[model samples]
Target: MSRSPSFSRPPPKQFNTRRPQPVAEVLKRTDAFAALRAGVEQIAALEKDLRQLLPDYLGSGVEPGFIKDGVLALFAAHNALAARLRHLEPRLLSDLQQRGWAVNALRIRVRPQAVKEPPPVKQARMTPVGADALHALSESLAPSPLQAALARMAARHLRNREPKK
Candidate 1:
């Protein structure tokens, strides 16, 4: 005949004399959570102040997007405005940091704009020379003996063509 397996007796439970702590009390006991809450509250206040401080020309209607990595993204109508904002970024970031925003950087993006083409330049016209002028110059410049013969021939031709006056 097989014997039944024996089990060990369980330990006795102790009753708590004190009441359970409240959720608020528990959260307060954790320093990390408290610091996180304070940081979030400060960030909210800083965001509100920043919204009011931004210029109206930067588009008062749209809200600026804030990144968790401490980068602030803003949109500009064109490259000129974006460049202007980039120039002032250092000061803007410093101001935000002073207000406890903890911003690491600011980025401005330009929206597409129509580009204008420059006007065309006008050029001067070139004058044309006659072939008769070129031939006369060539005949006058013929070498020594040839030059003399051409000159005599030209003189005779001119004499024959003269009027009987």
Candidate 2:
């Protein structure tokens, strides 16, 4: 009974029986996409080299953004990591230069990981019984700020529950 009725029917004419080409093969066929893929590969290679030159902690926290006009852009996970990277800029620049990289300056930017906030809490409504209980409790208490607050809360709850004309 759970089987789809369409299972007995033939597929529509729009369906293609041929297998699709691999993504890399498809991208390589387009000139623009091929260039973009090449740039991405170059950046990845640069990042790997930079990572090898850095300490474990710094390497893990940093990612190479891009290199343009002799300026290499780097993204750090936090301000502390960025600060550390900035301090090591001179040494890194020299090292990269010595390794035949045409880098002249390092541009470090903070790029923190996005944090997901918890869903908002749903407010609990006071039942008539609960409001009545609060009213009774307020009545029993002597004149005080707490008693007044409880009385106001009870009245508000009961008033809100009343139907309008």
Candidate 3:
């Protein structure tokens, strides 16, 4: 004998009773990760200060790196940006010193940035008015390949507008 299909509701899902811990808290609980996190935060703070000191146009292409023995490293996205950074090194060093950063010198490094392609442009959709116009034009034209092509285009667009059952 054939059996009938059952449509009863499934059992309830069981979730954990304990509350989730925040990422920062978890990182702080670990030894190695805590040190790494501290270093990353320090760099972020330095970058913020550097951004404030730099001109608006130059700030975006340059980033602050680690400071070693009173020398601060600056990474640039391109060679031209690196050259510009080098030209402004003395001013940047003096500004950083005035800000109590303990920076005595600036070293600029060229790090090529990855090129990103822009998003593809969307194709314009065919409106019912345009499709109707094409249909009328196709009707007015003589029986030729061009007329057939126009009729096909109009039909395709009009058919797309029809509601499906």
Candidates' lDDT values, in order?
0.61, 0.86, 0.85
Q: 1-165, model 1: which lDDT tens digit per residue? A: 436444544433432336675545555656878966565555556557656666766433323455558887766667777777777788778887887676898877766545668777855322223333333554869467776665565555555545789
Better of 1 and 2 by lDDT: 2
Using TM-score, give the best candidate's number. Answer: 3
**Model 2, runs deviating above 4 Å:** 1-26, 116-165
In model 3, where do residues sit more than 4 Å from their true spots? Answer: 1-26, 125-165
Order candidates by TM-score, high to low: 3, 2, 1
Scored against the true structure, residue 70 in model 1 reaches a CA lDDT of: 83
Q: Model 1: runs farther than 4 Å from truth?
A: 1-48, 51-56, 59-63, 111-165
Our tally of clashes for model 3 stands at: 0
Candidate 3 residue lDDT tens string, 1-165: 436446544533442336686656656756979777887787888899888988888898998888889888899999998988888888888888888887888889988889989989976579999999999999999999999999999999899888998
Per-model RMSD to reference: 28.5, 11.1, 13.0
Q: After superposition, how far is residue 128 of candidate 3 from its true place, in Å?
A: 8.6
Clashing pairs in 2: none
TM-score for each predicted model, relative to the true structure: 0.35, 0.53, 0.58
Residue by residue across 1-165, what tens digits does model 2's lDDT show? 657685577645544447675656656756879777887777878888888999999998888877799899999999999999999999998988888888889999999977769999967689999999999999999999999999999999999889998
